[model samples]
Target: MSKKKNKSKTLKNEPSSLHLFDQIYNNPHFHDIVFLIGKEETKAYGHKLVLSMNSPIWKGMFYTQEWMETKGREECLVRIPDLDPKVFLGFLEWIYTRKAKISHTTIYGIYKLAHKYCMPDLKQYCTVRFRKILNGRNCLRHAERSVIEGISKWHKISLKYLMQNSKKFMNNGKCFAGLREETVRTILEMKNLNCPEILLFRALKYWAENIQNDLIKKNKTEIYERILINPDQKKITARKLVKKYLHLIRLDLMDFKNYNELIKSGYYDHRILLKEGFNVVKKFDLKAKTKSRSGPQLSDSKILLIGWCRSGETHVNDLINSLKSGGIENVTHMDPTVSIPSLKAMQRYDAIVVRSSNVNSFYKGGNLGSNLAKYVDEGNGVIVIAINTLINNPEKQIRGKFQNQNYIPLKIAERERSEQCSLGKVFKPNHPIMRDVKTFKCKEYSHFIKTNDLNGGHIIASWDNGYPLITEKRRNDNSGIVVCLNFHPISTRITNDCGKAWLQETDGNLIFSNTLSYLIKDKLSKLAQKNPKKKIFYKK
Candidate 1:
């Protein structure tokens, strides 16, 4: 009979299995289980079979003897205490139709519900969604939750975001005060926080004041300030409120001026401030997570002086004394003829100052020029004083090793002259390296290593013959600073047998000291750029 000529037709009039389950979700007539949820006790309907198939917790609860005994009773209801109705409703929807409605407002609640119900897939989905919606405004809250839930990944990501926007978060009055005490302590404990310590202290003060005021209100007191008496007759003060987290701040690393201001503010106890002051003075903090977040100060920076340090000569000693007078106290003298430090050892210094009366010693130990070039590339500053060498001399070996340094910012040629009246005229007097440097006195017959090609460096000062005296060039990648002083090292102030031909005045000292200061400032500025704050040049 040709199989009764059966016709194949689409079932367009009926809903699919998933769509039918979704349509009947939360309908009391079709669901066997009724969930009374939240403080409002809102009702959510769920099918036992559908819930049991999705979650083992639901499966075990539904198959219990107590639930089986009341299977046919209409009064049987599952009470989901302390859960939002919307969150429970979303959970039921996922069980029935494999879809969830997730938003920022309900995500945290939904995640908790999913975790409580032993739903790994839903928990993973929520974790991915958390990453997408995280920002500066919500990072602290999310980080707090992550720590509680032991979710290490989101905790790290959230804290990293907090560190990036720490200046804004700490400076904003409302946001800073609204943070929970534990959350505030967690942020304070971070090692890489680059915000100023004074701002952190102020935020802590605001947070403590708010907490103290809240305690006062709870005790039915009229106190507006931080000091109040609680119901148990215990005194509440700002210091007591912030005592647990106070020591997390690196008080030793803060500027002494700011530390004094913190003491004057009177938010913390005098004993705490005194102890921190002791730590600062002793250069010792056993609890400090870092030495300095903003990079080394001029006093803390190490300078490598590679030059002649003869017992009777003051050429290198003069430079060292001037640098120390300008707050650069850590200068190490390394005679190039004796030994040249490894590149790894050279990285320990913030800058290197190279001055030599004889260029032959540069190639004595190792490749000093190449190591210096690599040092500058690794973000350290270099100052080259080529005043003693003769660039036009027919000595190829001496001149070749000196001229091969790519880190030198200028091209040296045969454009030099010996003149006793070759005074330095400041072109960029406002420049940091030229600060307080008007004119430097030239010693008797000082050799001027004049250069016409500056190689894109700015002339801070010049010879009377229009040659570049002191030129500054920053690396193309902004990694380091190079300052070239095109005058004889004999022009430096010294007191020795050859003091007649050497410099012996304050102008030379002021210029050299200012040049070292400028290089350190530039180096710290570069280090600050690696952090999250806006690029700001370190002001003298």
Candidate 2:
């Protein structure tokens, strides 16, 4: 009995049997077939029996007379020039071990190989993982690739997600470039898409610019010389690239200010605008029927937040979530230490929020101030928060001086008063921004803005100490709205610089929510009047 038990235990713990799974994978000792994958022709080893048992395509390639040309060779050489070697190895690993490591980065590549080789199990595995990881950033790319690969189910799900979240994705300008024209047209034709006409137009503009940029990148010298010869060619090519899908966009649905900005955008020819009656002259005409989308209210908008909170000083995540819960669909934060989009790219958002500090590692010398000023001048909204800069930090003050100019509604004073306080007398109580915004308090008092140097701005509210609490400005030409909330807003409970835990105010969230909504409404309103007709589609 002891001898028999020892034999069973030895069989269970045998090294050769235990490591067979690993040895069969990529081991040349038993590999009878070699795969040369990708453009580089990288080699991957596999056994004919294992691959043929798993994939009918591999079975036919190895045994059928159709590939008899490869018979009698020491090792069958299969040229898989389209697949990555690592992906091919992953598929082989699955055949041996019945489990393969998959990730967001490798699922699509692996799926393509699985589909091409007719391995249903691996393809199903890829599909499950792909669906789990599908998101706004990669949905369009995935949908496009799935369509190309004839993956009807995957294409439908991805495209459906994209259409449902069109407004959020479009406003953030994620992965719109290089999509098939047909796919773009299909998205534009989606009646259920909730995006505003202005936002959709901006996304299309981004797509066209990216396409033009790629073309220029591929043939830089040639395109540059051509552009030098005919400077208008750049805009001309941009307009032509998107010409096919123009009609799908409801241009008449856009507000007058945005329509005018589009005309000045130079992405479309003047004649096209005139011919299509997209000109401002036809904006208010009764014959021009303006129809809003069926999704969220036209009040649906996006915001770009450009600022960073130092650790322990502020809670940026809490602020972002608060804004999101407050009806803003998208709030994209651009870390100043990273990259800031150009003014043209900034056009995608209805409003931009600049936190106190405005220094960037990429754009040194504080260029965002000039760009944001130009952004506001181009008929978009801006909210300059937390006064301008810390008074003690001379370096931050110098770097953030530009934020106070151009679009900022007010200039920050030289001093910052850091003391706990509450909202004082309401100067503009009936104002949209002040709606439901009662009982505001801050652990730290904000810097005062120079009232005399408001540049035609108005003080909306004041602190208990009579400092400017909330200020707003309207451009002389009616370009866009600018609101300055004059406090170091800390939305989440955290230990302050003084090492004391400060309780967060939910009112802070309401204040920002109200401010963002007010800013967006100010920009997206129709010209001179609101459309009397409200188009509602009842669900079936």
Candidate 3:
């Protein structure tokens, strides 16, 4: 009688066969989902099953998604392939429910996927695994693309982390071993590869494979020529090379995806994806015979920052990113010591800005940084920051000077390791530079000395320290305004959520863009300057 009662109770409590409970144990996509072998995959991999991809799923598969959702985030089974079934399930349970766990193996797979999908958080998690197994040659290939793709995703990738794995990759990995010279040259010229030691390996790779034949041909040709034209064979960085060759893939470039359609549109070459990229500066005639009919032109009106050590891209991101977010992204950063091609890039800017830090780098007679000083006197109403050198190291001043000035030999420690913020923290709301920064936030980085040195300099803002935080000095009877000061800037605001919170969130670049707008409009009255203020929005 007890057995008969229990049987009746079970029949009453059982779910119908048509329900999701039956489907979960049967569906191929659901039941045999990829094995996530590792604590990371077991824990975070559950997100995949629950992912709300709106793309159509079959009506029959509806129950699969439903059951997975009902099971909850912490109670999923993630079995590793080729493992004892019971053991793997038990390990997955520990990881998902925090009961027991397994070693990490699915990390490399997930990391590559995370990178592809622009998952910043997940990519960071993969970084830990990459760093942990830096010595393991087994994972370098997967790891290399992970870092590269992540760098392509973020505004500026910190290479310090990847440097640790360099030696391990050099030991015996095919990814490092079989790297083509064109590929090596591409990375080097793009400024993507990091570290001197790592750089040496890539250089060694390029020389051993790609450059060897080219070097012999070049030597023979040079010997045949009677005249010798002095040349400076510039060393291209991997990051820069990638930028020159690959279409701007900081994110993905949108060329037509359907290959056959693109070819059918009277185009010849379909192999080269992302059609709008070339080494413009490297090309003899800045134009390329792209398969796409669109011709490349003198583009990117880059703002050439002429400043002392105070602005090392510390805060310019806010303004730069803001305009970028609203279908109006213009500007790329170039520092004097870090990237000098920027000086030549100056031809691109519609109007120029001379910041306080810039003044010291160009002015201050006898200082190495002061060599560029003559331009500051031009004052095309160029917005100059209010200051001299951020620090008083004579050696630093010497290193700042150009090659002809005999300052190149003296290598002073740059502020690469130091954080310098101007003690002054106030701003005058009415200044021209302030015209664009609606955030009204002051910069907090170390600024060089602000001199009332110019007789006509206007004090637009000041800090509690009584130093001028923002000032603009008139030059040549207002032909230009040399902005000089130590006030906080909008760049700090852009990076933090103070102003716009999008455009990959770097230091205030959009504010810098707005400032450029103001300067350009101020210089050439005929030029149309868009309404003041950083374009506050998110781009991508």
Candidate 4:
């Protein structure tokens, strides 16, 4: 029994047979297969059993009885002339150890080799690693090759992720010049792209210019002279190159000012613009509409309201109903704690109103302020209502907490003073926001924002003490219009449900509705100015 136990223990202590096979890999005496790769005739050695087991292609090539008999052990060699020597060696390492380092230079080659050899595991590993390494800085260098290989190899999903994440880096004009056509098309189709369409259009133009420049560089001196003599032909060629991408540009979404500039620059072909239904006259009409309050009426505008009014249900509900009756059809309310819509989502609405007591935490957590600023800069409108909640008491300066204060037209005071039952006077009686309404009374709690004269901000309404209670900054060349109300229209008593006893005031509600109408009307008027008029002929 003791002798039997000793024999059993010895058998259990022995290394597994697969471990022995691992030791034989790349061992010259054990290597039964040789692969000669690339033009350099680089050599890689491996065991037939190990290679065959790991790869289906290798199994079919080396394990068939006829192949084994036809190519004797001593003279047998498998040549992979398409793969790079370094890449084949990297594959060999992975086959032996189930691991290999893949760099940008070697990744393409290794991926191809892995696919050719039917090593699905290695192929998948390399594909995942390739995506991990791709980023904004390095993407421009690798985009062309990566797209070609990734598409051909059926790694489309990974490639898409890489392209989407790296697009922000393509903001550089030169970087865009190097992108493949496929890469540009794919990026433009992405619905969730963080970049504005105008930037993409500029990049596309740069790419077209580069193509023309490249054509000139490759031609004979006489051909170059001909191009210079017939510059229109060169322009035609560049236009043709960019034609495939023009439709991808969201011209409708571009601000009238920027679109006008693009048309006036004449960098692109007029014929192409006409084909896309983008006539310069139409844009001019749209611009004209902006200044004309009597331009064609627009469809009902959508407005987003954020933050709860400290005032009771009557005040909040009354304000909402007033906006609806004033022609603002759709109103969506959002909780401050919820994630704000992205800039792309914000584009759907004509105007946005943000009101929050804990506005700082809401802005920081949601990362919304910059996106909002961009939205306004793109020619949309924003209304910010500041309420001095208890949260603002400990943190005295409410203005400093605003992450996007720079975008706000009014200069907010660092400190806020509390006043009871103050009356606000109309500073700008003729202003569009106050077109229908005149003077309004403020509740017990009201805050003030100082104005910067250099910013071209207008104080449309002021407190009895001379502090600006409401300010309007019209959209200029650089940014969209912003209206800041220092005091809440709905009283805190209404928010606390105590003001329900008092009937909803018509004056305050009318002012809020007028403000909404002014923002929408202003935006539409600008749009109409750029719109081209269609001529109708009368049949006599």
lDDT leader: 1
Ranking by lDDT: 1, 2, 4, 3
lDDT tens readout by residue for model 3, 213-284: 433456634422211212353442333322333232221111233223323532223344336563323332
Candidate 4 backbone clash number: 23
Estimate, for each residue in 159-213, the C-alpha lDDT of model 2 and write its tens digit.
Answer: 6677667767777753566676556666776655666776777777777676578
- Tens digits of lDDT, candidate 4, 1-540: 999999999999998765565566566675777778898777777887787888888789776888978997664678777667877777788888767777878888888877777877888898778777877666645655655565453334433444345346646656566555566676665433445556677777887777667666865443334232244443446667566667777665566776765666565466777897866665554543222112112223678875554433565565566556553547877655456667898888878877654334253432567677677777777887644421233332223223335556554344354554253677678776776564455543444443333145677777677766667775566456777776654533345443312124435555666677677666665565556474321110
Model 1 C-alpha lDDT versus the unseen true structure:
0.68
Alpha carbon lDDT of each predicted model? 0.68, 0.66, 0.37, 0.61
Tell me the TM-score of each prediction against the true structure: 0.44, 0.43, 0.30, 0.43
Of 3 and 4, the candidate ahead on lDDT is 4
Candidate 1 clashes between residue pairs 3 or more apart in a chain or in different chains: 387-487, 493-503
* Per-residue lDDT of model 1, residues 430-493, tens digit only: 8877765656656555556666787667787887767777887765776588788887555444
Candidate 3 lDDT: 0.37
For all the candidates, what are their Cα RMSDs to the real structure?
Answer: 19.4, 21.3, 23.3, 20.2
Candidate ordering by TM-score (highest first): 1, 4, 2, 3
Q: Give the TM-score of candidate 2.
A: 0.43
